[model samples]
Target: MNAPRLIVGLGNPTDQHASDRHNAGFWFIDALLRHYPGQMRPDTKFFGDVGEVRIGTQVVRLIKPMTYMNRSGQAVGALARFYRIDPEDILVAYDELDLMPGSARLKLGGSSTHNGLRDLTAHLGTPRYWRLRLGIGHPRTLNPGQSVINFVLGRPSAADQQLIEQAIDRSVDHLPVLFRDGWEIATQQLHSADPAMQAKKEAKSSNPKEEAGEKARRRAPEDA
Candidate 1:
């Protein structure tokens, strides 16, 4: 693959879920749009918000699927098929629970924790694409009783949120390398750095309210 032609950030589209941990991919896209100053409009054919960004002389298509998160493949598959973009020439960004908060990593292949990725893999029909994992930390680290769904769908503490922002900004700063220098080079640079502005992780419980929400989400659908 040459440079990535399409970049998709996974998230739910509702305003209510805008600041949730699961929306980190959307936040990354929002940050990218702000940096590039492009028009991202809703397109029914794509079933999502679509835009173009020039990263190192390449005009890359950006996608933010409005099809919630579970069926995000519908949007991704549509665009990929339309553009005939190979699975290799694509990148996806989404939240990760395995890494501790304030950390981020770039890699290829499947991260099984994300349902959005599951859909993308099924739709794209390959696991050979690049991925950016914005660490969200595990729920068990925050609180033992906390469920995975609640941890991902809930908003992080203000301090933690700031750390996430720093991670996003740091990733954006490495875009030139990410697009122009190939995934391996970009991954090395991104994985090696310690985030300079990453705020401190908070010392607190996941709270009783979140535990309740956790049960609800588990009973409901996947909140990728």
Candidate 2:
């Protein structure tokens, strides 16, 4: 697969949403700017802040849509069309509620519940673009009574934010590999680096008989 040429980070505009969990994408972009030699400038034409950075031989463009989260497509589509960039050459990073904090996943061509992504797809006319799902966690799992809108628009707890920051840093570090080595190698490297995921895998790999015995005991009460 071709490496991405344009990377869009989905988030709301303004200082108000800066630290919100919904701005995880913006946080990733900030982290990327720290790692790469680039500076963002406001581009009225694209309706967002745009920047460029060299990743090895390729020149990659970065965008943080100022159109806010729900209408992010307005900015992304403008940039993509002007550059003649194919959907395959675009990668969008945004928050994911389904994933736990500190965990991230990279995938291509899938539907999402995110309004930002949905609007993006409408503009691009395809869902084939790559996506970097940064986990901010879901309210349903983290706080049973909280609504998703409030949870995402709100800031994460300090502990959760720390984990999310680590994930962002890891993702940003993997971009060079993604640009030079391609998706498979980059994805594997990124996913493997997630400590929480590794721990879960290790737990699952423990003694099967012991695990089975525990499951059996739990089921015994139901069976009785």
Candidate 3:
């Protein structure tokens, strides 16, 4: 039988870093655990909490490396070697500032200047692994360095937290699809318009009478 595919989530393991924007990977893993409570118990061999789920004949292993975010490759490389898993079968989920909040993109290769990814590539000797980039969104001007750092380390605002939480929940629901249908189709389904957008579209397509009624409702009595 073939070994299970591995899904590694990169993040620091500390209360200070728990809710940070950079810890979206951790948040995603937590979301997955909540969704599959029986699967992701702590395992010392993986250097963190590890869980397993079967997808037909394939077994998928979920890993949350406890070596901290910066040196995540240490734990990840060790686990991969121990399990005899190839880099191609590994999927990494991490935060990316390039994308907007509530958005996620999955791709291969190393396009951005991410130290964690660079380190992983160096350790694995290739950039062939799958990456799920969860966007934390870029910062506004005025002290950009501090802003970026703060974003990575600091807790999000209430609204941002809600967005991130919702995204995390959505990610949990879509993860199986990711493993089954591949990234492209899964991404389309994940990032597609929300119910609000669908409602607006439906409203726009209403009969002419409804449109006239809406317009009349917007007008003053005299104007109507």
Clash count list over all predictions: 0, 0, 0
Could you tell me the lDDT of residue 202 within candidate 3? 81
Q: Candidate 1 on 1-224: residue-level lDDT in tens?
A: 47789889999988899988999999889898888868689999999999998987889999999999998989999999999999888888899888766777878786585899999999989888888889888888875799999888899988889888888888888888877787778877887674532221111123666667667888787655
Instruction: Score candidate 1 by TM-score against the native.
Output: 0.84
Q: List, residue by residue over 1-224, the lDDT tens digit for candidate 2.
A: 99999988889998999999999999988888888899999999999999998888999999999998989999999999999999999989899999999988899988888999999999999999999999988998898899999999999999999999999998988988998899999999999998877886688669687678778998998999
What does candidate 3's lDDT look like per residue over 103-190, in tens digits? Answer: 6666767655776787788778789888877767777632256667776777777777787677678777877776677667776777
lDDT of each candidate versus the true structure: 0.85, 0.92, 0.74
- Candidate 2, residue 211: Cα displacement in angstroms equals 10
TM-score of 3: 0.76
Cα displacement (Å) at residue 35, model 1: 1.4
Q: Cα RMSD to native, each candidate? A: 11.8, 5.6, 9.4
Top of the candidates by TM-score: 2
Ranking by TM-score: 2, 1, 3
TM-score of 2: 0.91
Worst 10 residues of 3 by lDDT: 192-201
Every model's TM-score: 0.84, 0.91, 0.76
Q: Is candidate 1 or candidate 2 better by lDDT?
A: 2
Tell me, by lDDT, which candidate is best. 2
Deviating ranges (above 4 Å) for candidate 1: 195-224
